[model samples]
Target: MIICELKNNQRTDALVSELVDIWEDSVRATHSFLTHADIETIKLYVPHAIKAVPHLFVARENTGSIHGFLGISGQKIEMLFIATQYRGHGLGKKLIQETMSLYPITDVVVNEQNQQAIGFYEHMGFEVYDRSAIDEHGGTFPILFMRKP
Candidate 1:
């Protein structure tokens, strides 16, 4: 698979919808801490967040269909999600490496309840430097602030 920057093409609308699906599927698989209500609530903000992201990239097959995406703002990775079937294939590491090549990514925040994600970030060379009792939006879920040395 090849990774490429997501451009606003004629298929932008359809692609955005697909990306949201990937996001939901990924969250459902790993975020066992979330209730149905919590998932629905967070879904409300994802589309808007996707639209507001300044930089976005996708991992695609030779057929050019996207299987995962990453969004970054400056040096922070605001979002990253792989289609459920694409996880554990090192595509996420590829995306991070590509993004880091383009930006000085020094930090990331992960939900403490999402152990899989926390482990993945740790494996990718980040270490927890701080903790918050609540998420960035003041939600009840705790968060871990990690940085790469």
Candidate 2:
């Protein structure tokens, strides 16, 4: 697998579409608390988010098939998603480590219901420093704000 940063010119509609598919697949696998309708609603905006995020990185096989991606803005991790089939293969961990090597990422907000993600972040040396009863979209899914210390 190879991890590389995507330039702004590389954020084409086709690439954003592919990333959105990866996002939906990963979310469905991990975000069980979300109803189908919730996923559908959130999916509408994913492409825009992927296109607009300040930084984007992708992990791909030697064959060039992207299996995971991360987005960063300022010091926060705006997003990270790995294709369901790629989970547990250290792709996400590698993406984070690669990003940290290039940027001073200190914050990542996770859905509180995603215990696996919380544990993963904690294992990566982040700790929850804040919480929100509603997500950024004003949804009922709780959010946990974490920081690396």
Residue lDDT tens for model 2, 2-106: 999998899988888899999999999999999999999999999989988999999998998999999999999999999999999899999999999999999
Q: Top TM-score: which candidate number? A: 2
Model 1, residue 141: what's the lDDT? 97
Error of 1 at 117 (Å): 0.8
**Model 2, residue 83: displacement in angstroms?**
0.5
**What would the per-residue lDDT of candidate 1 be over residues 1-149, giving only the tens digit for each residue?**
89888655523667788889999999998899999999999999998788778888889999977889999887778899998998999999999999889889988889999999889999999999999999999999999998999
Misplaced by over 4 Å in model 2 are none
Cα displacement (Å) at residue 98, model 2: 0.6
Pairs with steric clashes in candidate 2: none
Residue 86 of candidate 1: its Cα lDDT?
A: 88
lDDT of 1 at 15: 79
Instruction: State the TM-score for model 2.
Output: 0.98
